[model samples]
Target: MSEVPSPRLRISDQDRESALTALGEHMSVGRIDIDEFGERSAQVTAAKTRGELSGIFADLPEPHPLLDAPKVAVSEPEKPAWADIPPMQRIMGALLPILFIASIALIITTGVTWWFILVPIGISAVGEGIWGKGWDNAHKKLGKQRRRELDG
Candidate 1:
């Protein structure tokens, strides 16, 4: 399209140069890799007419004015491990272990029936912890082990 209307018209040096620059622009943004660029550049250099030069961009996306506008980078979504946990579940996961351990210490110091109440609460806490975070944590542990093996 950079050339004159005649398909058989002999391409000038400036036309070949322009085509090569466009190829570089496409490659810079990962539209094509180094091997494809080399092959296209070779074709561009060997092209004798306007038609031959046009063939190189046939399959590539058309470089319209809209496409030439500034691009916005799309970032990956956040992946916080705790994002899916309910507030009460998260609180239970954090508090149950500490309170259970403290209750054990209290029971040791004084033989009291009040400490018995912690038994069901301790079980509930453990269950909530497993439900809320167990799968993600297990996957992360497995991934780490696999990576360590691979790296070794």
Candidate 2:
């Protein structure tokens, strides 16, 4: 009632529907007759502005359109995919750059070219960190295949 900011504000289908529902409630309570309900319902349906709806409820009490506040749903904030990784895995993932740097330093100092071996290890560590236990299953499958090859 008093909440409507302006009389001239354009009404929506939802607003009209709310008014119609209120009118129906009024009719059911014997506040308004069927013919009067029909007439008021038509008026409500035809209402294009808040002003047009205001007069329809002028004679009625309590049950009015657009009086109750609409409800809003609140949701929890989403976490990033990396946030779900285990703490140990996250630590290993973080140390991957240091692994590469140390490998490169070893390669430069020793000139043995064995630093190439660290690349796969660093890649596997980071992959396990990001993909979690899924990487362990894949690693197991690879190991099984190698074992079958040796046994055969």
Candidate 3:
């Protein structure tokens, strides 16, 4: 970015685009005024030679991208365990409420008391989910430990 490129050298599309991008960054950060940015941007787009492109940015400092990277991409972040809304929880959450309402209506109409069976089933389902999660965590930990043992 130090040496102004050869003035008379033919420019490539990439060179023009790079200059245009640099101009945009400079304008966005208030290094140059909007009018200057617009004028230079037009000149950059129409520039046919490396010198014409270089002249547009001759007075400006290097753009931000040239100074430092904006961001480094790491691996995609994982969703937390709690954020993983399981399908069974979703289905049963809705079904439980509906079942409770139906149980109330059925008891009021028939006094049969048989629809109450779903209450125990719902409680057991919750316990199963809690236990299942514990088992999964324990299983993963054991797997890691086993791998380490084998590697050692």
Candidate 4:
């Protein structure tokens, strides 16, 4: 069985500060007037034990610091799966569209099947990203540095 805590337990400065803050909240909400706040603030300042501080909030409702629940911590939202990939892959992916546009433009202007050349090059570049290793360790390190520079 757990032992019951003594009312005579010494209160720390932090405990006194919390009680004072609670009293300030009570005063701010007009629950306690300025005169009563002064009295309560004095009591909080002179408090030496847990029992002494407890009486300061006896007549008040919620917002009692000692009795209040701890605040919950908020976690960061999840990042997309593709956020971790190196820049080379994204660049290669982007290259395909540009190549396609250029091929179309060339075909329209000169009308000589420019796509035959650009299409294979674009496919090979993008295919290397999908199937072949995009970069070695050194290149990956450089990509990370570049990402940091851009972000920072």
Give the root-mean-square deviation of each candidate in angstroms: 12.5, 15.2, 11.7, 8.1
lDDT of 4 by residue, 21-137 (tens): 988999999999999999989998998887888888889998875623354568997554346656766555556556767777777888876545667476766567665754223
* Cα displacement (Å) at residue 69, model 1: 21
Best prediction by lDDT: 2
What tens digits encode model 3's per-residue C-alpha lDDT throughout 1-152? 57754668776666666677888888888999899988987887788876676667778888622322234467986544434545555444446546667777877888867757577466547746765543323334445566876797
- TM-scores vs. true structure, each candidate: 0.38, 0.45, 0.38, 0.46
Q: lDDT score of model 3? A: 0.64
- Worst 10-residue stretch by lDDT in candidate 1? 62-71
Q: Residue 62, candidate 1: how far off, in angstroms?
A: 3.9
Enumerate residue pairs that collide in model 1: none
- Count of clashes, each model: 0, 0, 0, 0
**Global Cα lDDT for candidate 2:** 0.75
- The residue-by-residue lDDT of candidate 2 on 1-152, one tens digit each, is 55647888888777888899889999999999999999999999888888899989999996899733473468886554445556665555566656777777878888867857568586866687777646534434445566876797
Output the lDDT of residue 98, model 1: 68
A best-first ranking of the candidates according to their TM-score comes to 4, 2, 1, 3
lDDT tens digits, residue span 64-89, model 1? 11212234568997555556656655
